[model samples]
Structure formats: structure tokens, C-alpha cells
Target: MNKENIFSMASESVINSDDKLALEALEMAKSKNIDLMELLSGGFSAGIREMGEKYASGEVFVPELLMAARIMKIITAEIEELMETSDMPKKAKLVIGTVKGDVHDIGKGIVCSIVKSNGIEVYDLGREVPPQTFIDKAEEVGADFIGSSALLTTTMVNQKEIERLLVEQGLKDKYKTLVGGAPATKRWAEKIGAYAYCEDASDTVETILKWVNEREALKEMV
Candidate 1:
């Protein structure tokens, strides 16, 4: 199939939560020599963004979004495996995880997959992650960004602790931070001194890309 056709089918797969169609698009991309990143970003991720919108509008619920996320994960894994031997330059590195006391993994997992698909190297710290672990791993990986997800009001304070620890360690300016989840808002991000508030996977990807571009531009000026 052609690029446009494959892209269309890939998008439909996510919207419909069809794993078979998603894998079919992956196969077509391989057969036609279509760049996997393009298929991921322009096709599957595009569909995922739509799902986010629909979920926000209450047209879709958690179950639907969860299924879509699963489909995304499958296709993304395939792309990641294919690109492993290829020299796809990473745009930036990010450490992402669910904050402490929150066992919710759906939102964090979706963010990790989508962000990684955008050519950013993501180190997923997994759910129930301690605030300090984020800092520790980011330090180890030399991460450019640290992202946290909090699905409950009580657990949200851990995200704040991450900010406090960064400042306490004199590393507040060393890395950008993103905060998000069902209970998180832009105001919450500002209150906690996070770099950006991401509402969904697509928003997280866009915000991170913007940060990466702005950082690159600053380097150019320097």
C-alpha cells in the first residue's frame, strides 16, 4: 500500500482499537519502506490524539482510552524494535513515572509510549515511583525532562516534593519538569513550579518538543 493509505489505516486502527489493523499498517510500512517514525507520529499517534480529545469531551470513557493505549503500545513496540539497529538520533531524554501512592499506570504508560515515539529517549520508572527516585534516575540518565503522573489528589503532593527536591539539590534549572494526570491542572503545575502541564499524551509530546526546540534555539544563540 501507499504511504497515505497506510497512514489512514494506521489511524483507523487506533480509533477503532483494532490491533490487527495496527499490525497490518506496520507490515505495510515495512514492505513499502515507509519510515516507521512517520507511521507512528503521523498515523498512530494522530489517532491517539483524537482519542484523547474524545475522552476529554466525554464521548469516550476510560475503557475505550485504555484499549486505544494498548493498541498504541503494541505498534510502538514494533517500531522501537525496528529502529533499534538504525541510528535514529534521539531528540532528548525524559524520565517519566507515576508518583508515589498512585498505583495508576494507564496515563503514565500512555505518556511514556507517545513521548518515546517522538524520538525522545524515555526511561519509564513505572507506577508507585518515589519522588526521589525520579531525581536519582534523571541524574543517572542525564535526562532533559522529568515527567510525573498523579491520578489522585492525595498522591499529587508527591509531584510537589519532586520540585522541592530539585530546588533543594540546586538542580531546579537542570531539567524541565512536566506534571499531569486526571486530577492535574495547569494551575496545579504553576503552584508546584513545574515547567509545563500536560493534559494528555499528545499535549505532553507537543510541550516536550517545544522545550527541545527552544533549548536548541538557545544553543544556536550561544
Candidate 2:
């Protein structure tokens, strides 16, 4: 199969939650010398992302979404060994989590997968993470970026607390802060003094890649 076809099949496998097709797509990708990470981000991850949207719109139920997530985890595990052997240098480190008071995590999990596939080292702190925990994890990992997700308006206020803590600790300028979730907006990010507002998993990857590239260019110039 051609690369596009392989990618499409991979995506469909996740969307349909078909393990057989997913494994076939993985084999095809290997035969075609396709980059597994690219297939994961462009194909499998894309499928899960669509599944997320379906869940959000109530077009699909929790079981279907969970099944798709299961398929994603399977495919991710299959390729993880290969991905780890890659010689590519890590571009940056990111600490990510769902803010405290929000137990929703499927969306944030997708963001972590996409971002990590793009060469960023991701430290996933899981759901119901306190703002102080976010800062602590970022500092522990010496992360370049800190990302928080809030699925509820009440929980999104915790994102602001993350920003406040950064400033209060005099670490505001030390790391880039990114905010996202269903209730998070550009205005909210601005009001919280966050560096960027991500609309989705893909946007989060793109924004972080842009920042990594800019930082690399600056280092080269210096």
C-alpha cells in the first residue's frame, strides 16, 4: 500500500476500533518504510481526535470513545519501542495535565500523544492536578513549557492559579505557559497571562513546534 493509503487505513482502524486493520496498517507502514511516528500523528492520532469530537458532539457514546482510546493505546505500545530507538534529539520538554477539579482526561491524553510524537518530551501529570503540582513537575523536569487543560469553567480558574503561582514564585519568565480545554479561550489565556491558547491537540503540537523552532533559531544566532 502507498503511504497515504497506509495512513488512511491506520486512521480508519482507530475510528472503527478495528485492531486487525490497525495491525495491518502498522505492518504496511513498516513495509513501506514509513515513519511510525508520522503514521501515529497523522493517522492514528487523527482518528482518535475525530473520535473525541464525536464524543463531544454526542454522536458517539462513551463506550465507543473508550474503545477508540484502547485502540490508540495498543498502536502506541506497538510502536513505542521503535520510536525510542530513534536518534532524533529531543526538541523540548513539556509538563501537561488536566487542572484540579476536572477529571476529564481523554482530550489531554490525545494532546500528550501528538506532542510527544512530534519530538517533544511530555511528562503527563494526569487529571485533577493542582496548579502547584504543574509548576513542581515542570521544574522537576526542567521543562520548556507547561500546559494545562480544564474541561470545566470552574476548573479553568485553576489554570489562572498556575499562572499566578509562576509569577508569585518569580518563575513567570522561566517557562512558557499554555492553556487549553473546552472552556479555555484566547481571552482567558490573555487574562491569565498564558503564553498561548491551544484549541486542540493538533494546535497544541503546532504551537509548541513553532516555539521550539524559534528557540532553536535564537540559540543558533547567538
Candidate 3:
């Protein structure tokens, strides 16, 4: 199959929540010697992006998004594991988790998978994560970005605390912060001193890629 054809099929697989089609694309990529990077950039990304768009438009609910995430996880993991053994360095490093007081895992899991598929190394800290835990894990994993999710208005406050703790530790410049969840917005991110605000898993991946790619370009220049 052609690249665009596979891309469309892969995307439709996620939209339709078809795990078999998703896996088929993975096998086709390997069989045809098509680069996994190309497959992810085209196929995997297209799928997750559609899910994000639907969620943003209120055309789909959290359950639908979670289902798509579950389907995409397989392909992303396959590509991520394949790339790890190669000479390609990870596009970026991320430490991700749900903020304290927010026990939801669906959104956080989706974002983590999307980011990982895009070639970023993600260390997911799981749900109900403390603000301090984000900072600590980032340090341990040498993460370039810290992402925290909050599903409630009250829990969202912890995202700010993460930024505050980063400043207190004199590490604000060392790591960029990203906050997301249903209630999060660009204004909130700005007020909280975050580097970016992501509306969904796809947005999170896009923003992280922008920064990671820029950093890579700068390093290449030097």
C-alpha cells in the first residue's frame, strides 16, 4: 500500500477503534521496510489528531477518546520499542502524570502514548501524583518537559504548584512545564507560569514536538 493509503487506514482504524487495522499498518511498515518514523508521523499521528479534534468539538466524549487511545497504544509501543534499539536518540524526554487530587488515568495515559509515539521518551508517574513528585521524577529521568493532568477544578491548582516548585528549586529554566485536562486553558497555563497548555493528547504531542524539534535544531547548529 502507498504511504498515504496506509496513513488514512491507520487513522481510520483509531477513529473506528479497530485494533486489527492498527496492527496491520505496523506489520506493513515493517514488511515494506517503510521507516517507522514516517509511519508514526503519517499514520499514528493522524489517528490521534482526529480523536483530539473530535473531543475538542464536543462531538465525542471522554470514553470515545479513551477507546481510541487504547487502540493507538499498540502501534505506538511497537514503534517506540523498535526505534529504541536503533541509533536514533529520543526526540525529547518527558515526565508525565495526573496531578494530586485527580485520580483519573485515561487522559494522562492518552497524552503519554501520543507523546511517546511521536518519539519523545515519557516517564509516566501514574495518577494522583504530587506536585513535588513531578519535579523529582523530571530530575531523575533528566526530562526536558514536565506534564501534569488534572480532571477537576480543584485538582487543576496543583499544576500551578508544579511550576512554583520548579522555580523554588531553581530549575524553572532547566525544564519546561505543560499542563492539561478538561479545565485547562492557555490563560491558566500562562497564569501558572507553564511553558504550554494542551487541550488534549494530540495537542500535547504537537506542543512537545515543537519544543523538542527546536532544541534539536539548535544543538545541530552548535
Q: List lDDT for all candidates, in order.
A: 0.88, 0.87, 0.82
Better of 2 and 3 by TM-score: 2
Query: Which candidate do you rate higher for TM-score, 1 or 3?
Result: 1
Worst 10 residues of 2 by lDDT: 80-89
Query: Over the full model, what C-alpha lDDT does candidate 3 score relative to the true structure?
Result: 0.82
Cα lDDT tens digits, model 1, 99-203, are: 999877755765776676678898999889999999999999999999999988999999999999999999999999999988899999999999999988789
Number of clashing pairs per prediction, in order: 0, 0, 0
Could you give candidate 2's per-residue lDDT for residues 40-136 as a string of tens digits? 8788878987887988899999899889988888887787655553466788899999999888776677677667767888899999998999999
TM-score on alpha carbons, each prediction: 0.67, 0.75, 0.64
State which candidate has the highest TM-score: 2
Shift in Å, residue 217, candidate 3: 2.5
Clashes of 1: 0
The candidates, ranked best first by TM-score, are: 2, 1, 3
lDDT of 3 by residue, 49-126 (tens): 788889889999989987887876677677667755334467888999999988766557657655766678889998
- Candidate that beats the other on lDDT, 1 or 3, i.e. the better one: 1
